[model samples]
Target: MLAHRLACTDPPVNLLSRVQALMVDFFWDRMHWVPQSVLFLPKEEGGHGLVHLAGRGAAFRLRFVQRFLTGPADLVWRPVARALLEHCGGLGLAESLFLMDLKGLRLNNLSSFYGGLFNVWGLHRKERPECCGSLFWLLREPVVRVSRFVCGVGPSLQQRLCEERILTLGQVVEVCVGPVWTTLQAWPHV
Candidate 1:
């Protein structure tokens, strides 16, 4: 209910922070010491992850733009959105909204709106790239960076891995568990 209201009106950053802070405080009071980074992790990674509310709200706003673009002609908002898009020309709904700078158009803050738009479009960008039957390609599919998979693994480790010609997660797994495992384990940071 609160989110729905927030979605309509451009809620302030302080309000969003307050809500997140309250959630954190509640968990802290219960003796749950989960890290913020861990909270953002996927469930498969063993964290009780929550979808970002701002992202969801941005998606909701974009849904309106989508409806305007693809929805039945009978709908009232569709015509308005279509007219706006036609008037703007070339620019996408998200871009048009930013360019117009309409005072009445309430997007739940700029960062959330942009983040949501990226989240929606980024998925499509990832899916379109064809993996050409390569094991390394498949391993690199989910994440473009190794640091995202393993928390606290810094740029130095990444550079070392690259220097050793170790690229994908599959390679990392093979090296860590294969005959080279002992040698890798004997390395300074391992």
Candidate 2:
């Protein structure tokens, strides 16, 4: 319910803050000497590992945005979302979400959501070839799964590739198909 409300409306920050403060005060009253940070620490570190609601709320909002983007298109709400995206001028879903975050606009705002989506769509919009020609098209295809190409690479190596900003098979093919093969060989065996 809270997640739905957040996804639909921008709730007052003060109300949220006050609720958080009250919870903190209640905990503090019972354990006068316990540092507030202790509540947030991992259990292995001798703390309760309680999540702060404001952070959780922010995470929920992001998750909601992600689900709206990646969720099944056949969902009942998908048409509404698609219509909203179309009305915003054909923006890609993720791009629109990113722009909303960048502009400090509320994710629930249709204008911001649509604007960002349109911006992404505009950036990636390219003339479709009459037939698939070069492998380069695989890189441009938004729905292409990179995992199929990285099947044999260990998770650690994949993490390294991600950390280096080599996110796609196209990028790996471009970067690793050269002298980078030596670098790959040098990676320590797991």
Candidate 3:
């Protein structure tokens, strides 16, 4: 809102000037070295580092399984997690914020560290011996955008949008776990 208001240059209420003043005040008077919102991880991970979702804009930066998440490893690294056994202890929003400034050393290995992140969704897929590993890193924005476009306004005909939706958001897009082709029910309300 501040950015938007400042961009509007109306009459005497010079939003740009007001924003410039605020920016000056923020930079000189209220500036801090680090953002307070960043949440720290346990000494086990590495730099008792932090991971915090800044705002809706920050949230949009998220992709893959990590996009919906907030806070640090402690909040998400749960032991009961379906795939990875290492993240038994889960962290949450407020509690994780307490360690914001601390920089400690994590004792765990890198594989154990991100178990909650990349491993969580594998539970639904059966291990296939014939399958090969993928070295490509995926961007989630396309998947999300495609899913929204297909599901938000397309025909429910399983033949059309259903497979597309599942491919985009995973089985969760259609509330089913089988092949994307199987779940394409005709749009119910229409």
In candidate 2, which residue pairs clash? 91-117, 91-118, 92-117, 96-116, 96-117
lDDT tens readout by residue for model 1, 32-107: 6877767666799986665566566666776755664456768975554444443332222322232232333343
RMSD of each candidate relative to the true structure:
18.5, 14.9, 19.1
Number of the top-ranking candidate, with TM-score as the measure: 2
Give a tens-digit lDDT track for model 3, residues 144-169. Answer: 22322345444444234334443233
Model 2, 23-135: lDDT tens digits are 77777875667888997888999997766765665555555555666666667866776566533322333322222222322334466434334333334424555576654
Find the candidate with the highest lDDT and give its number: 2
TM-score of each: 0.39, 0.44, 0.19
C-alpha lDDT of all candidate models, in order: 0.51, 0.52, 0.32
Local distance difference test, candidate 2: 0.52
Please tell me which model should have the higher TM-score, number 1 or number 3: 1
